[model samples]
Target: MPANKLAVVTGASTGIGLELARCCAEDGFDLVIAANEPAIEAAAAELRKIGGSVVAVQADLATTEGVDKLYAAVGDRPIDALLANAGVGLGNAFLGQDFGRVRRVVDTNITGTLYLIHRVGNEMLRRNSGRILITGSVAGFTPGSFQAVYNGTKAFLDSFSFALREELRDSGVTVTCLMPGATETEFFRRADMMDTKVGTDKKDDPHEVAKAGFDAMLRGDSDIVTGVKNKLQTTVANVTPNEVLAKQHRKMAEPGTAKP
Candidate 1:
């Protein structure tokens, strides 16, 4: 929230990342935004119009080397905030999906996120004054029959964010997980889920989701669900049997499954 504090955001070329970066810039935080596209440069340019300093880092977070490249760009500067939002999701029945694509999804959504959080979180701990915002998902609460790997990755994120938050509770730093249900983003289209109900249905605006995450992180809340429907779904998931939830999820996501 400081005028010149540095904020680092990943997966910032589009969707929630882009919206978060925009909000950060508007709020006067200097930014280091990273993603695997030249669009990052464009995003930085637009954000700078609001008079915030911005640096663009283009890196594929699925690899350790890429993650290192991003961190190296930060040098020794203390990041006031970090958003580990780099991840990919693949949807379709697991067996019918390409193994390589699944691995990439896991590598990005799980490995990259964990590695960045481990490294950045250590720095934040040493400083004892910073905030971390992780992009988790409602998908993590239930079995995603078709998006097996993607959902599994989010499950790890949701749990990891909480455990890490607990571990850092006494430290001055804060960790918050932003769990959003379906949002209008390129995520579903890129993941090849346009035909799916979850993908095709109207979704929460990306700006709204980003605002919820930004505000929650600033407040140092441990976790936040972005919308009313998402909150209700979270409640239902908690009360429903796993078998029933899994069946419902399968109908929504699994290839060849009949529409509900």
Candidate 2:
């Protein structure tokens, strides 16, 4: 809300993360953006043109070292907002996928994410002023038959975000969760799901999703699902049986389900 507020956005190389950073830039917040790829530098360059300082950190945020590196970049500077949107997804049966890849997904989506939150969160609490936005997913509600590990990690994030919100309820800080359905992003491609129906299906726009998230975070709402369809999907998931959900997911995410 001030001229020099700082916002930190992770997984900011592209997609929803990049859009989120753009939102911060447009809102007049200097930014610290991170991604494991070198592309982060390019993203920073793009944001700088919009006005305000933009620092990019190319660190493997799935590791403790990486999280520490990003935090060090902040170096005692007060973070007005922290957008924890760094995460990865993996597709296919858990037993058949590479274990290393699966581990990376877990580490990136949960371990490192929580580590960063713990660090920034304490500072926010100490000052009693800050906003935290966690990028969770509606996929968390179902048993992802083909995307087992990725979905499991999201489930953790969705639940964790709420519990943390409650703990910090009376404080000057607020935590919001952005739960979006499939969107136009590199996610499905990176997950090697190009052949799946969900991967190829028309989805929500990243800019819209990011705007909804950024607005909700500023408003300190509990959570937001980006699209009308997604809102309905998650609501139905709440009542659907896990067995049924898993079957439905298989239809969308199973390998080679993409229409020919």
Please tell me which predicted candidate would have the highest TM-score against the true structure: 2
Q: Of the candidates shown, which would achieve the greatest lDDT relative to the real structure? A: 2
Show where candidate 1 strays beyond 4 Å.
1-3, 256-260
Models 1 onward score TM values of: 0.96, 0.99
> On residues 1-260, what C-alpha lDDT tens digit does candidate 2 reach at each position?
55599999999999999999999999999999999999999999999999999999999999999999999998778999999999999998889999999999999999999999999999999999999999999999889999999999999999999999999999999999999999999999999999999999998999999999999999999999989898899989999999999999999999999999
lDDT of 2 at 75: 77
User: For model 1, how does the per-residue alpha-carbon lDDT over 45-80 read when each residue is reduced to its tens digit?
Assistant: 888888778999999999999999999998878989
Q: Please give the RMSD to the true structure for each candidate, in Å.
A: 2.0, 1.1
Q: Which stretches of candidate 2 lie over 4 Å from their true place?
A: 1-3
Model 1 residue 174 CA deviation (Å) reads 0.5
C-alpha lDDT of all candidate models, in order: 0.90, 0.96
